[model samples]
Target: MDFYQADPTLENYWRGVILFGRNVASYKFALAHALYEVDKSGSDLVTLEELAVPFSRHLCQHLLHAPKQITSRGSQFLDTCVQFNNGELTQDTLTETTIRLGFNNVIDAFHNVNAGEIEKRFFLDERKTHKGIRITDNFYQLSERQQYQNLAFETNARWNLVEQAWAMGVSRNLVAIEFDEQEKLLFSHVNTRRVNITSCRDSLNGYQKGRCFYCFKPISLVPADTELADVDHFIPWKARDEVANINGVWNLVLSCQCCNRGKAGKSSHLPSRKLLQRLHIRNEYFIQSKLPLHETIVNQTGTQPAQRIDFLESNWARAKNNILFHIWEPKAEGEATF
Candidate 1:
């Protein structure tokens, strides 16, 4: 699926960075939040010190909840942020440390996805000539959009999901994750208690490129909207007992109300083989993101791509054999989007 050509909007490019960009650590998200902060001030040219304030602030705020921000060990910048959070470091020291160590990678990698820079350059790296980044017109246009506020919410939501997955160390254990259909959220069990991680719709909308999983239509992120997105189980959650880890993020996709539970919506039905293939592709997006979802899916399915496809196919065959389900394809079809 062409990520840009499917939507080809400023928001789509921004979503590509937030939702699909590689994150060994969450520096991309912090830089993204800081960009939004400075974008509000209408400042085209933001010095390193000006950028470090919100950049360090967001990291500090997230660190209060999640102790581990990076996948690997030992980040001097994160250590400084932690010290600041623990009242051991001054604000000036934190800002200076952030300016020195924080932007080393994230500034150049902010617009990157799948190891390539996105067509829309949100900000230009100006550290060589000027000790700061220059906000591009694309970013200003994004900020001026009506749904700009929601983009920030979506970014935070994605960040929460990734960090929570990392913090839980899903690779080590077979996580006991439960989905609340009522709240449309995912909860992970820790020490016999469940903790809410993030909203399903907000976390998933970007992967789907803000389109319905089945019909490829725009799904609303606004709560008050009539067509707010629905978190649909790609393999049908009703078969949870029969299928292992059926409610995992691998099986979840964001759908519009009409395609989810309308007159022709898919309910307790097997999706078509094409949709099954699409599910594989969608799962690849999660895998490439390297979020905890990747580990969880690999734990449930398989590590190798072929093995993963075999897992999906095997499940589909089993579900088709036992349950009497009419194969479901969206009545209102649109272009294919992963």
Candidate 2:
């Protein structure tokens, strides 16, 4: 049977849960319930404080049941989270805690849960000290890693440019292009005449069909889009100066004009590289395995001989891992409020 056939009405329910659970107050309760379900086989045995550690434990356990390819990519994230928890909690080690909880088995514990119905949740304590500091530190570490990667790409591109210059025995004059507040080309050596911002905006809208790449929000009504769809550096420009050219396609992305304005010249608030790697693995597994299973279950149930319980179990395990990585987690406060 296809995974979705087991639970037909899951996608809509999951989307709702994800939307509502992002609220700080609701998130704590939702996370507590998830933790209790994993730990005590019911949602009645755990207190709020006990929920925190087990949430991490459940994440690790679910990861263990994922496909080998996915699990391989998750090693870095697991080690990083363990280290972070160890250092942060100090007295209690994550390794000891995970082992004590008897979650070392690679069993498919989440097979019964509807994969599409699971939503990412978080816990927040208003009175907790160092909360902001921890969140900020995590964001900074990931940002630095992304910046480093961008710089590396820039260096390679600069080297290529130098090679081209040497072969030509002369170089064309470097053009300095500057965009105005409206994203119109205000200054350019190639064309001294000012480029119309409205034209650029219309061009971008046509390209992206008026949708923001990050949040998938419609940008047609956004006032900033009237000037131009903010051309964003996928790999930030500040840290990658070598290839920070005025015309690099790989570095650019279509962003919501509002988000572009707010996030101008700013880095993204991504999770650690370790965490990102894990998320990448989970994402791939979902696309390769679980998504297919969901589609198959929805369309071809009882038509295929290979549709065994074991097959479904494996696929569900893969989906469960994807959910645990929090790949669909909403933005934190003040990040993507457009």
Q: 15-89 in candidate 2: lDDT tens per residue?
A: 223222222111222232343243323332233245446545444443342212121234543563445544664
Query: In terms of TM-score, how similar is model 1 to the real structure?
Result: 0.84
Q: How high is the CA lDDT of each candidate model?
A: 0.82, 0.31
- Each model's TM-score? 0.84, 0.23
Off by over 4 Å in 2: 1-182, 186-198, 221-229, 246-250, 257-338
- Best model per lDDT: 1
Clashing pairs in 1: none
lDDT by residue for model 1 over 217-325, one digit each (tens)? 7777888888788898998876776677787777889888888888888877889999999899888876766666666667767889999999999888887777766
Task: Give the Å error, residue 210, model 2.
Answer: 1.1
Q: Where is model 1 more than 4 Å wrong at Cα?
A: 1-9, 88-93, 114-116, 144-150, 168-178, 190-195
Tell me how far the alpha carbon of residue 160 in candidate 1 is from the true structure, in angstroms, after superposition.
2.4
10 residues in a row with least lDDT, candidate 1? 170-179
lDDT, candidate 1, at 82: 91
